[model samples]
Target: MPSVAEGVKLGIQECQHQFRGRRWNCTTIDDSLAIFGPVLDKGRKLRNWTKRRQAREQGSTPPAATRESAFVHAIASAGVAFAVTRSCAEGTSTICGCDSHHKGPPGEGWKWGGCSEDADFGVLVSREFADARENRPDARSAMNKHNNEAGRTTILDHMHLKCKCHGLSGSCEVKTCWWAQPDFRAIGDFLKDKYDSASEMVVEKHRESRGWVETLRAKYALFKPPTERDLVYYENSPNFCEPNPETGSFGTRDRTCNVTSHGIDGCDLLCCGRGHNTRTEKRKEKCHCIFHWCCYVSCQECIRIYDVHTCK
Candidate 1:
């Protein structure tokens, strides 16, 4: 008979380890495993109980490690982490007791976000969670169905930025290029120049600042747009068009719209199966609005929003 330690490893190896969907949860042969395939595929070893049993039957259980072999414990500990991520192990799960495991801060992580695991792991786990939800054939967002809640990080923060939320200026801590280019044109002149919503904002702000006299500068100085105001301003600009609300028809000008978690057959092929125009909104705004608009955004596709154009 294998020891408790061996059983722990075996449990960790189970890929359907703790499989579950919005309404279906399975990690065993007797449970529905079809829907959990992708999750299993992502970390098969961590969720393959049958393989663990086969190995146990073959008398392949390795000898227990001493304190000197603590590295082995790291794998075992991380295996538990993976299981928790898969929504198995009931109650609460946290890594414990790894002396040589420098993967993350070595300590008890009973509380979420208390232990700082590498950002990459957080990103990967969040992605798997997102995928597990998106492909689940359910209309519910992951926010409504996912079991793990603390595994996500902003893309910028995921890159190891010390901070990503409100900065010293009490703003989004994120922005773009500077205004005072060596060319140094007037702000209003620059605003009237061509109006690149992205770059021209900087030019406009610069003009507003310099337009005042130094004596009254402190009182009548720059009229910078607040976060709320800027948000409304860019509601149409690229700077503000992220995840641009998939409402109504893909055509910005079209009145009728249809946004649903429908089948992915067309999205995967960029064919939309209906001759829709997948051109960027920026590109569309530049046009004379003479064509019939039919656009769809396969978020997984290009980084920009596009308008689907049809040939007359």
Candidate 2:
């Protein structure tokens, strides 16, 4: 449970880091435990049973299955697997530990001596627990499951052979190698790339012998199909130029933007062509630090002024 909590925290931090320049910024709602505020809210209307039924019968699209949601699901799942695998390697959990089942002999100069982080165990734990609640037959469930697996897949794909050298005078006579997960930042970067190239999917519904069946298919035939490691979403992302309660977009109001950038984070785009407000502020910082001979250091204070631009 502690590992799980740590994983959630890790995912949130990574989300914020990756999207800090974007409109959403992965802001968390203070009053709700849904984390990224109402961006991922789906069941809010479920409390009213009539609306839920109408939504199901009419096949109305829910605002929860956007590309941002896909990224969130993938990152969260990856975080859980990463944290659990790390904990298992550290022997923090009694039920799981290092992977001792690595078969075959070692390489010419290295042997598998150290504990290998059990990524399979972590993936299994994440799959069984994280995917258990998404057992519904709807397309949303399928989308969530696919993104979750993609996250876990990122962890597995990034596992590398980590080794330690052994010998006198730091000379490498032999090395002990073990499988280890990559840094979480690397995983986040990979997933962010995936997010950029995420596939747009369409929900295909059909009448089956059992009942109504729904599956996701690529929206465009011109593009390549999304693989298991790729992220997919059934709906388009919100433009995020203005406050939208339905899509949970807080808008770019007061958001800082890069004046030189022409991308989404640029002032022109982020401010939605309404222009921006600029302000000059003074900031004091430590400057001209010099190390003393006695291993101490001292610095002089400096005042700096710069123009800050924010969305109107």
Candidate 3:
């Protein structure tokens, strides 16, 4: 198994890559970790409060699980799984090897050979390490677990089959096939879609044979129950236009934006209606190219200027 640090680094990289153009682009991983420490501490306090049977005395509102949190958790877990599985297949980790438990024999035209990447092992290890961070067995923990599983499931559901063909003069006589993980971008896109449709959930307590168990349910009656694959949250997020130390929001001031974009990355939207500053930048690049008789190609340098927009 790869080290925990390796998995975390990969997760952070994926998060940043996926949200690069968004307002809350996950630029505060260190702050997030620091905030998580306080979250765990509060979880312990809440657990004690519940045990004392004095929940009515506090009258404090429950912590709100925002969509941002859900996205972060999902992407982080998926990133760890992806990194670990790829590392195993590449022989970078000593704990495991390529997946050899594929079913069925070679078909008429194709053979199922070569080491298949082991995603199951990756999922198992990710769950063990990532889920361990949630020490309290509460609704928040359950929510985190669900999102983590959903992330792993996204990766597994998107695995693609790649094949190499072998034949005489491209006759395609035989083929070797293996299951490969999809591009990280695909996973990011899928998660982003889920984030758009994320549901608001409320944690409720129910008495069971074992004990009083907390479970997450949709906060709105009209909203359907969230499936294992859906992302769920409990709280609304800050506007993120200005820095909020309590919520760890760094704000969008001075960030680059697309001048012509009509989406979230647009100057108007990204700057939160504060407007933006624009400047022209000149860039040099290879333009005209000619192929030589042998194989060498040559290109001429060209200069181009474009406007760059930044949030105020």
Candidate 4:
């Protein structure tokens, strides 16, 4: 069983990988940890802000949750699950090992006897660790818990069985199979899609027979209740184009951008109409490679100058 710290590190790596091209990329791991702390201390502060804003609004346009927050919640939860499951398969922990118990029955010219990755154990441990921190009986706590569980659920739903055939000269005389978890990158990609469609939730206090109960309702009505697999949030994100220490935004000033790109990473979008400064930069590279007989290759050094653009 890897320590909680290792799990957090893995989660941070995944967050950076998933949001590498986004405006609010996960560059400051420490700041992220502060926001998504064990008890979500920073998140709690945001929730308090939400309450104050609602009080002033008198129940109109409650709050728009930020996609960055949703992504963090999902990726962090998924990171823990991915790391623990991978560690189990690698025999890094003595407490648990590969999931051999779920192997399929023998026959059909194949045997399901390999050490399958134990994703269920990963999910169990993740829930115990991540969900335990959210002990608050409030809407924000509930929302975080739901997003964390959704991350684990995404991993389990994507797991698949892999098989290898063995025989004379690679014939299909016999086969070995095992359950495998999808690559962490794939999980990250899936969650990125979920983040894109994340929903804004309405957390309201309702009177119940027992007492006052906090309810999490989707802002928009859907054909069915919001899926547990969807990411949900309760507050809008700050404009990341300018520095805002309070909201943790460092701004995009001087950030390098693709002049030809029309996406978020492009100058037009990333600079937020601030325009950009262009300058020529010299870059060095190895080029003109040649393969030698025995088993060697050679290349000549090359230099090229290109125009680099940065947000003004």
Candidate 5:
């Protein structure tokens, strides 16, 4: 898919198509732009376009950078009711893509002041920029590195930087902030509506099936998590029998069976036990729908007397 600029270009081209249908002159595009949607928001782009059009009328080409910027502006300006509460200044960290912390994934980010996409959506842009600069894709490579390494560059690294606040949360200065979208949620009707859909999903895939496993995993993922403590590493073994000492919490355990943070009973949490390799025996007569484990046993029938020899 094209960037937000590309999407805007397409939208503008659509407006041009509509304007041509009415057989109106295409000399001044501003009127057509407004009819289609928001022509300009910050006034910076609007001002630039005015000058560029005037310059072109004088038979001189606009500066290369200015032309590119104006074209990108035209693409973005084709949106509906775009509002730029802010703009870029020298002091603030402007990045390779020129997207500020206030801005987002260009195409859809500006549509509603609430861009519709996933957290990793920015990754695509980062990869594109990196490809242009020949940099690496890892967050570290995309961050403060002056030398673009593995063809990956993006504006996301600045988001994770520590804010000038004493608390651990995001900048305390912001209230109903624009940058904090992926995690933000409105109360009242909004929450109710979102929950309504998710609730239906939960009921449709009720527990006692694989849904139970998925639900359990999602519930665990939502946990806020406690601070790090003196965690250690140990392995649960077939012959070895031991329980966690410092913390009883399965979450704050010292070590894991496997490094991957997957199924609790997998390489994570406690080991799967000696059950990994075991043998089973079939009843000589019939199982009688009964099962036993060492001293523990279950049966459909109950005998009043104990059979010492038969029990084993």
Candidate 6:
């Protein structure tokens, strides 16, 4: 339970860090488990009024499964697996601990020793718990499950061998190696890359052994089929330039932007062509300090001015 809590916290922090400059910014409503409020709803109704009208005439499409939702599911699931694996390695779990049986053959003068974090066990726990709620017979459920697996798979893919030298004085006489998880930031980076290139999918309804079922397929046939490690979504994302509760876009209003950057965080792009305002401010800081014989030090105050840019 402690590991689960730690994992959720880790996931949320990494999510916020990864999306700090983006429009959505992974805003959480409150402290409860529903951190992502209505943002997680069936995505904002297709922004265009024409599309909405057409959809309404065409029997109206189901709420969309947005890429943002895909990312949230993946990161949250990965966080849980990572935390649970760390707990196992640290002997904090009663049912699971170091994966002694999953090591590879011994190498030159070194054997797989020490507690290898049981990432597999952690993934199993995540699947059993995180995936249980996604059992609905819908394409969105399938997408969510896929993203969840992708997140856990990232943990497995990033596992590396760590070694410790056992010698009299730091000599490499013998070594103990074990598998370890990569830094959570690295995992977040990988997932973010996946999110950027996430495949857009369309629902495909067909007959199955049980009955007619809904599945997802790439919207474009020429595009490569998405693998289990890839993130997939069935709807186009909102521009997120303005506050719209429907699409969960917090909007870039007043959000800090980079004046010089030409990327997404830059004022030009982030402000959605609305332009930005710049302001200069001064702040006092320690300029110089001298250490005394008694270890006491003093510094002069210096004021520095810098320009700040925010979306208008």
Q: Best TM-score goes to which candidate? A: 2
Model 2 agreement with the true structure over 1-312: per-residue lDDT tens digits: 789778878987898889878776765433223433343765443344344333321111125788888888899899989999999999899999999878578889988878899999999988886788787778988999999999999999999898999999999999999899999999999999999999999999998988898999999999999999999998877777775445555567788888989998899987889999999999999999999999999999999998999988
Which structure is stronger by lDDT: 1 or 6? 6
Tens digit of per-residue lDDT, candidate 5, span 1-312: 224334234334433332221111122323232311222111223335444443331111111112111222222222211111011111122332223334444332122233222213334443333234314333212211221111011112112221222224654433222342111111112222221222110101235533331111112236442111101111111211222112111121122233333544333233333222222333333235645656665545433432111000
Per-model TM-score on C-alpha atoms: 0.16, 0.88, 0.82, 0.85, 0.16, 0.85
| Residues 209-283 of candidate 6: C-alpha lDDT, one tens digit per residue | 888788998999998999999999998877777755455455677888998999988899988899999999999
lDDT of 1 by residue, 114-220 (tens): 22233234234434433444332221222112211221211212222122233466665442211111111121122222122211111122223446221101111
TM-score winner, 1 or 5: 1
Q: Candidate 3 regions off by >4 Å?
A: 1-4, 29-64, 206-213, 297-303
Question: What's the CA RMSD of model 2 in angstroms?
Answer: 6.1
Ranking by lDDT: 2, 6, 3, 4, 5, 1
Off by over 4 Å in 5: 2-61, 65-120, 126-312
Q: How far is candidate 5 from the true structure (C-alpha RMSD, Å)?
A: 31.7
Model 3 TM-score relative to the real fold: 0.82
Residue 14 CA displacement from its true place in model 4, Å: 2.7
lDDT score for candidate 2 against the true structure: 0.81
| Predicted candidate 1, C-alpha RMSD | 27.6
Distance from true location, Cα of 268 in model 4, Å: 0.9
Better of 3 and 4 by TM-score: 4
Q: After aligning candidate 6 to the native by TM-score, how far in Å is the CA of 162 from where it should be?
A: 0.4
lDDT of each: 0.24, 0.81, 0.73, 0.73, 0.24, 0.80
lDDT tens readout by residue for model 4, 27-55: 55233344366223232224343444323
Best by lDDT: 2
